[model samples]
Target: MRYQIGPDEPVDVAVVSAVSAAEECAPEALPQLTEAVNPDALNEIFAPKDEGPTRRSGTVSFDYSNSRVTIERNEYLTVEPLDVIPTP
Candidate 1:
């Protein structure tokens, strides 16, 4: 994921793990909600309205890549093994 704090601000980037159940050995599912652009707009739309709100300035854009979701199951359905694995 890549993030831009502002036009002149620093750009932050990272790779996010999208898996929900790693213990089951299933491929990580891509996040349902990814890539937040123009958090300023989001803040305006969802920003809290209360006293003593800390003031901050800056815009951030989050870039994300979608991952595939895989299903796994045991032959005996005993939940002993998980079969799905994500391949990079």
Candidate 2:
């Protein structure tokens, strides 16, 4: 599954939504994203900047809701079953 995050949307929100879709469950039913990663820190590293240009390149990947969630700044977000995510 894949999702594109809007410039103003919270990364955590997108993560929850994407992960929920992958898990075939409601967003509210999924485990807290904080259990997988620090939402604040994740957003901070990828968030659009006020003093400089927006970030266009970076990757943050972790396990969430039994899926592999990977975020590409300003590019795309991907979610897949954990087993499919090659060990790296």
Candidate 3:
């Protein structure tokens, strides 16, 4: 599932929203959202720069719970199930 962040919406909030939707549960009922990178830092890094061209391309992916979440430069957030590995 893909979700777009609303204007002024924090990336962290978007992440939780996506996860909740994918799991078919309320955000509060979901497990704590974890990220490999600091979400605040990500927002700052992806923020529109006053100087030079704005970053038009980039992607960040991380594993959260049983899902792999990806946030793209186009403001699209995607959540998908991770591949399950069979134990020997």
Q: Pick the candidate with the highest lDDT.
A: 2
Deviating ranges (above 4 Å) for candidate 3: 83-88
Measured against the true structure, the TM-scores of the candidates, in listed sequence, are 0.19, 0.87, 0.78
Shift of residue 46 alpha carbon in model 2, Å: 1.0
User: Per-residue lDDT for 1-88 in model 3, tens only?
Assistant: 8999877888888888888898788888866765345767767756788999888989988877667888898488899877653336
In TM-score terms, candidate 1 sits at: 0.19
| Model 2 lDDT at residue 29 | 92
Candidate 1, superposed: residue stretches over 4 Å from native: 1-36, 50-63, 67-88
lDDT of 2 at 27: 92
> Where is model 2 more than 4 Å wrong at Cα?
86-88
Candidate 1 C-alpha lDDT tens digits along 1-88: 1121232321211112222232222334434333433434533433334778643443322333332222111000011112332335
> What are the per-residue Cα lDDT tens digits for candidate 2 across 1-88?
8899876788888898888877889998988888999999988888778887767689988888799888987467999998776786
Model 3 CA lDDT for position 30: 66
Minimum summed lDDT over a 10-residue window in model 1 is located at: 71-80
